[model samples]
Target: MEDCGEHEGTSELKLGTTIIAVEFDGGVVMGSDSRVSAKEAVVNRVMNKLSQVHDKIYCALSGSAADAQTMAEIINYHLDVHSIEVGEDPLVHSAATLVKNMSYKYKEELSAHLIVGGWDRKAGGQVYATLNGILTRQPFAVGGSGSFYIYGYVDAEYKADMSREECQEFVINSLSLAMGRDGSSGGVAYLVTIDSETVEEKCILPAELPTFYDPDTIES
Candidate 1:
């Protein structure tokens, strides 16, 4: 479950899902698989992991569902206040820094990792990864247990000059591969694309997911 902390209660939902974000030519694309589980049982199949923290900024969550969701909410509220104080839109870096500080301060108690990405007038499009008291701005970021299976693929396939459409396809393809291989990641795929003028949200259902291989042609 992606190094999740021990649940204090049996009823707590554990989210061991895949979350990723990619910076494209004009903006950022963030996505996640919609499956929440508790121990060996699946509790929810359509949970949204992409959260809007500000106007164009969003975060993709992984690890304990409760911890991640609570953290996102707190960050959202703070960013709103910060924007009001500054009399301008908040930068994506500021939102990510808030997440990093909180995550680091509560590292002992919280088991969550997040990818913060969005568009700002100053930076255009940016992607930042935060976890284990560390924060880095990258062209792309992936998290959760499913990430272990796709590191090599992402490293090999990612391109710095990818267009918006290519980035979207890349996220969907990567999620499909992970969902096929990781038992914890499944159900529909939720994606959000943020640019200077628009925030686009889309969903890819299980039946509509792209097929990558023929089972009969594969070796177990």
Candidate 2:
């Protein structure tokens, strides 16, 4: 993956990019673009950045593919153990807290950014983000180099009361805009929505670019 930036006072390489999560009326939506880059070169075209930590909990990773993958596996393992011991699935916030605590342990050596979102029976839908070992719960979160483009679209278009379908469209549109403007972001976008009853995922291909119109070319 491309090195977008480095953490302060550390040589830990940060790579991969572009992850977004938003909470809507009835559920939460999270997604990421499929492109993986290294420096100026594209390394993989179909990388999956989103991971299902539990039946309803999902995490999106951005930075250091190895670290991200390892982190997800560790979190998932913990969640699984919790579920088996408690006789119930862990809450979304619990999962986020678990990740935050684990992240702190590797703060100096690992450069990884994560967006965790899910739906819980008692809490409804929730979203959280982590950066430089600091994790915060948010209404929405964006990470990676392409986040600069995503924030603009989200600021203007996102609505907290939107439905699942609307949120999906908004996420696809936001990712498309980012891919168009950010060289490090591209490929198909994958979305996951978690509600009280179920979790759903969809793949949205890049939208077709608008065709230019010329006033002088009119012909009846």
Candidate 3:
């Protein structure tokens, strides 16, 4: 894969990262697995990738971890700058535009990609989102895989209406499978979800066929 930015030549990326957004009667819910790689796992197994940046604004990010962090920094700066410039944080609208511009501009160097979730107030307030994602309608995003095992398993039961737990289980397992078959992805799995008030974090161990298949086997 091409280097997105500081994460240059970084071959080991995550596999089966699935971000699912559901709009409920009150607000929206978003979820993602916590797996960074199958072969290598960093400490702090959990990351708050999803955030309730504002009362109505929530964000979830995925992609090259480093690139994702950079983009998030840029986003945080952009929001602050624009907020001071306009006195009101246009998080949702601005985030959508911000991500699009970043992705379009740094598609080659920045190791960044994203799946954003949030809500905006046009009149009554509505949840809005954008995704320049690698996966179209599939349940998961497999970045580092041989395309045989990862895709095969993810596509087998990728339900758009899956629950948060189900999605997490499927993605964590998929990462394990990819790490076993592919050289690019393996390690541990992470999960983050956000709502109107707060964000939650969960990490799981890879499901490889060895002495390491327990869900409690997390590194970070």
Candidate 4:
């Protein structure tokens, strides 16, 4: 995990993290690990990386914690104003664009990557990824240093026609895989599922995480 940037007011360097978002048949699933680190120390163990942009729209945050959170809050405010002006929920694309614009404008000062997804009247469900000013709509998206460990796994396992249950499982399994290998990602896994009618949030404790390998069989 590389040092991304300094934490809000401290000299500690905010480190790596893991965040993911996947679009399923009926909705979208987003998740992340709860661990927050600074340099070689764990500064926070219960941070919420999945933040709501609107009632149904959400974004998974990575990179500088303060920068990412501040950006999300700003986007949420803008979306709220837009929704009121239009008398309707903001579109997923519009929310993603706002994130992209902010990231691009502050590319020099901010180091954050966001995976935005949700369900709206126009788009039943959508997922978008924004980083370094580039915005892309994807069936699924993954970010952060822990993400480096699971690129092959994601590519091999992802399916465009996955059901809601399958997508949720996929997200949990992916997070567990990365957490197990990446020093910078661990603790409980937080998840959010957004559909047209409702938004559901869940958490998987470390003890409940799936075991990918037999600890007893590993070489000392």
TM-score of each: 0.92, 0.87, 0.54, 0.94
Winner on lDDT between 1 and 3 is 1
Could you give me the TM-score of model 4 versus the true structure? 0.94
Candidate models: Cα lDDT each:
0.89, 0.81, 0.50, 0.90
Q: Which is superior by TM-score, 2 or 4? A: 4
**What does candidate 4's lDDT look like per residue over 28-68, in tens digits?**
99999988887778888888899998989998998888888
Model 1, residue 174: distance off in Å is 0.4
- Model 1: ten consecutive residues of lowest lDDT: 1-10
RMSD, one per candidate, in order: 3.0, 4.7, 7.3, 3.0
Give me the overall lDDT of model 3: 0.50
lDDT string, candidate 1, 1-220, tens digits: 3324456766453547999999987899999999888777778889999999999999998988888889999999999999999999999999999999999999888878889999999999999999887889999999987887788888999999999999999999899888888889998999999999999999999888887777889888
* Span of ten consecutive residues with least summed lDDT in model 2: 206-215
lDDT of 2 by residue, 44-161 (tens): 8778789999999998988777777788899999999999999999999988988888788888776677889999887889999876657788888888878886676789988868
Clashes of each: 0, 2, 19, 0
User: Which sequence of candidate numbers ranks them by TM-score, best first?
Assistant: 4, 1, 2, 3
